[model samples]
Target chain A: MSAPVVELVGLTRTFPGPPPVHALDGVDLVVRAGEYVSVVGPSGSGKSTLLHVLGLLDRPTGGDYLLDGVPTSTTSERHRARLRGGRIGFVFQQFHLLPHRSVLDNVLLATLYSGVPRAERVDRARAALERVGLDHRVDAAPTTLSGGERQRVAVARAVVTGPSLLLADEPTGNLDSVSSAAVMDLFDELHASGLTLVVITHDPVVSARAQRRVRISDGLLAEL
Target chain B: MRRRAAPVALEDVLELAEAETPPPPPPPRRRRWWGRPWRRGDGFDLRDLLAEGVASVGARPGRLALTMLGTVLGIASLVVTVGLAQTAAGQVGRQFDAVAATQVVVRPGSVLTQSGEERATGRLPWDAEERVERLAGVEDAGALAAVDLGGAPVTAVPVNDPSAPAAVSPPVVAASPGLLDAVRGRVVTGRSFDAGHDARADRVVVLGARAAERLGVGRVDRQPTVFLGEVPYTVIGVVDGVQRRTDLLDAVLVPLGTARADLGLAAPEELQVRIEVGAGPLVARQAPVALDPGSDDAFDVEAPPERSRAREAVQADLNATFLALGAVALLVGGLGIANVTLLSVLERRGEIGLRRAVGATRRQVAGQFLVESVVLGLLGGVVGASLGVLVVVGVSVVQAWTPVLDLPTAFGSALLGGLIGLVAGAYPAVKAATVEPITALRGGV
Candidate 1:
């Protein structure tokens, strides 16, 4: 119903070897604006490779990826980086946060490369942290926070740039049940407010929270 | 759609909606044949780059200090060695100036006779001292000659002991009053014969210190007398420190007029002129012409080489030896910086990868590391320069020599550290720029 934020057509990724391995094979998918999509797959099911291609971190061998109406498959590295910084947000399972920096500083780092204005970066980072329900802990270091709090800080960093699409790779794989539900509730609130999200996970319960689910296996995808 | 039961804040929704709308894209332009389309404000601001660099460099203080030690020692040693060389050379030059650099000797030119025998061509004027002293930079000038007593057996005692073993006779020398000053010799006892004695042709002599000792004359207060070929001369004084013409110490010196009147002496053979240091060549050239204006080559003059030339030669030698040592230390310092920077790159691969993922261009990533190393080098340079100055001053103070340090050289050495850092950081910065975001994020090589 809405404008497509992510479009994948005939996406293929093959690693060069004595016998080449195709990690992504003829994958086709569309994530519309304001949609919450979950990609479910088992180990060695090409999930990581697909996520990488979708995140614009890896180049697809043969395909067209249209991010926000821009054909990005043929774009230069600089242009892709610009798009990745200003248009896309990523959340990895490890919650890559600088342990030495404060929560506010970690969130502010995302704005540094995303073309955020110098005068407004701090205010924007604070606002993003508040939205994640961690306004009281903006000055705390990541190492001092629990696993769930660190994940929340990572989320704040991801959304600080107001990316058009948010990509999460196993956002709750390391979290307890209580924290997982809380993170899912936060995602639901974000999706209800018209933010597009694509979450990759292996858990059935996690995938069930999304409006649309796609299972990936052997380098191909089937909608469920 | 599966809706969540939790309520969402209206402001949160509004903020998300507002942020979701991306900044307006630039108007499309004609595609260039080479390179990508130019984007406005694409890279980092200089202020932000510097801030990030400082933060990262300050993150590990212990490692930073350890890495800077090599550069510190390199620059400090370079400055110290060069400074000490200059200071020590100055000390040696001063001693040289006092003696060798200040003295000039002139002698009558020799001519070949019909029989192929060498004979003196021209004689020095009787008033050679007065004539040469008028020249600028001439401190003292005098005339002297070895007098032939015609087989005279000179003795301190009136009678010669012919029955005893034959004793060697001390030669007699006739010198003008200015000779003592020219030779830079000081009288050890009583007084030297003055111009009055020369004018009156007085039979007075200043014995050399060793000659006085040989003659058993301890003090001139008793008015000791020595006989030169049956002529008696009063021992007015004894000279000890003969800086130039050291042979004067053993000779019995008498008044020039007295030698000509009593001993039938001819014109003086040689003239000794003590010029100011650094004025050797000027005085040497003018002294020969001043002695005999009729002929430029009337006298052969020997002056020490130019003071600056000798000083420069010594300085050059010192520079060559010390600079090699400094260069080796500097090279080691550069290698240390490179090795540490490379190790830092490898250790922080994840951080570099994350920076790349955050839309940092390869150049920006490299710039950060470059700035870090340059700052390290600059800091080391400052510290090393200060230390070098302190050591040079300390050594100079201890050795009681004047410390000579070129300020520009010290400042330039500090900047050289920055240059070394630049060269040392190049490879590591390139390596850091090459890190791929995907592999880095996946925690692979």
Candidate 2:
């Protein structure tokens, strides 16, 4: 690879109180272009913490975070959010589509946040929904969709912006095996379509689908 | 299939966005709707703000609708009350101005007996006119003598027709030319009093419009004859109408001298006086005493200037009353707005937090609330203004009154309504702006 898409050096996060609690300690990491990588750990091992920092949802307590080449550690909240909305697409363990919105509208919301023109959002949303085989379910409620379909809708929302990085915080965490395979298969298809995918899960079966696996323990990351 | 890789990270997007940013910056923020219109900024654009705000709020339609209702009603109430009060004030000013301004009346008689016997005389002597005319403070003074229709047995017979209905004129001194000036009449016929005519108590007369028209007496120089107490009188000029019902315009303006002789009203029924220029105090005291129209009272002194002053005082009092009523309406509007804002703040705790998390400053949040409040006030003002105008115009059309739509009054009412909304919205909007997002999102009120 010409250069890594993301590089984090000596990243540490500490929340202040009577005695400071360290959420992440002295971490160095690199994510190459279009690579499907999984970070898996038990609770409190900082897998989600690392994802938050990488996704621009939060700044590291101490670190140099270089994206492509420029720095994000010192950027304003506005810039950080702009970057997050434009570049990084996040999929939560829970399908977090706003409850009141239709599935198509939910997909359009991502486009709206990314600053698409008002009239273009619907067509873009439709095209995104079709990519996940949900074109016919355009006006359906997010709540009405089954576990697998809802997860797919969430995935559709994530990739709608054509974001380079797709962070999946346990894509099939809430699904049964049958539904899990459906979600995993969709991720495989997206990976083939040139999206850099990061799946965070403690499931060994989930980890097995990734091209490379990284284990996090006690705020430390190890390649497996 | 080849394993694809290339994470679109933050740096890549920022680089792209920096390059894509328009050079001239989208028409320089396109005129901010709130405060400073079209001032240059380092990217704090109201258009962008509105777009983001609408999207964020639109995400929750039920809550937004409920909040909008509260604001709209608050603003509307403000506008309507203010507009109505102003319309009423204008109506009062126009009608009252036509009649008098700060006016007072001075009737002459005290309460007296009705039996034909000359009881305790409730009278101002007809000759007392000289005394009133000479008063140093009095300006624009004139004396008028009246003849009671009840006491007279007069008949009118037009020369050409010879048998028309008797003109209902009692007989009056049409006095000096000053009498015409005193009651605001103009001689549209031959001429008014010359010295000789007034001094000799000439038997020449002027007919009021109705009397002249009825008697077929349109001539200016040809001497028309009318009988009064069996004596014949010559006609002189004509005027429009009687100013007071008790005093007849339809009556003749016989020379003041001739009227005294012809009517035998040496002891007059009432006296008319107008105070001197700027003699407000004298005239002011004169009117209430006069023009009372009741027999129990002494002779009523009808002082024009005083009556006008009293009318102005009455109008002022009415204006104050309307202002107080308007104030009460404003209070109600304010309370309603406050109640709504408080409820909105409480209901929208989570949403406020979300906007803050999305990068809105405290000022921006508070400002959004204020803008919403102002919009409510303006909307209400628009609706209320339309209703008020309709009422004013409708009244004018149906009742034959003129409408005076004063801009200051209209704007004043609207501004007051806006003030009510702003005051009511302030604390709640601030409280909403300052709410911490983490806890609000975690649990809502």
User: Judged by TM-score, which candidate is best?
Assistant: 1
Candidate 2 regions with alpha-carbon error over 4 angstroms: A100-102, A113-120, A140-150, A170-179, B1-73, B90-98, B101-174, B177-199, B203-445
What's the i-RMS of each model? 10.8, 12.8
- CAPRI grade, predicted model 2: incorrect
lDDT per residue, candidate 1, B244-296, as tens digits? 98999988999898998998989898899999978988998898788889986
Q: What are the DockQ scores of the candidates, in order?
A: 0.21, 0.06
Worst 10 residues of 1 chain B by lDDT: B29-38
TM-score of chain A of each: 0.98, 0.96
lDDT of 2 by residue, B44-120 (tens): 23654555444545556566555445434433443444444445555665564443432224445454456645454
In model 2, the Cα lDDT at residue B73 comes to 46
Clashes of each: 0, 47
Q: Please, what are the lDDT tens digits per residue for candidate 1 over residues A51-123?
A: 8888888899998999999999999988888888887887878788776678898887777787877777788
- Candidate 1's displacement at residue B97, Å, is 4.7
| Total residue pair clashes for candidate 1 | 0
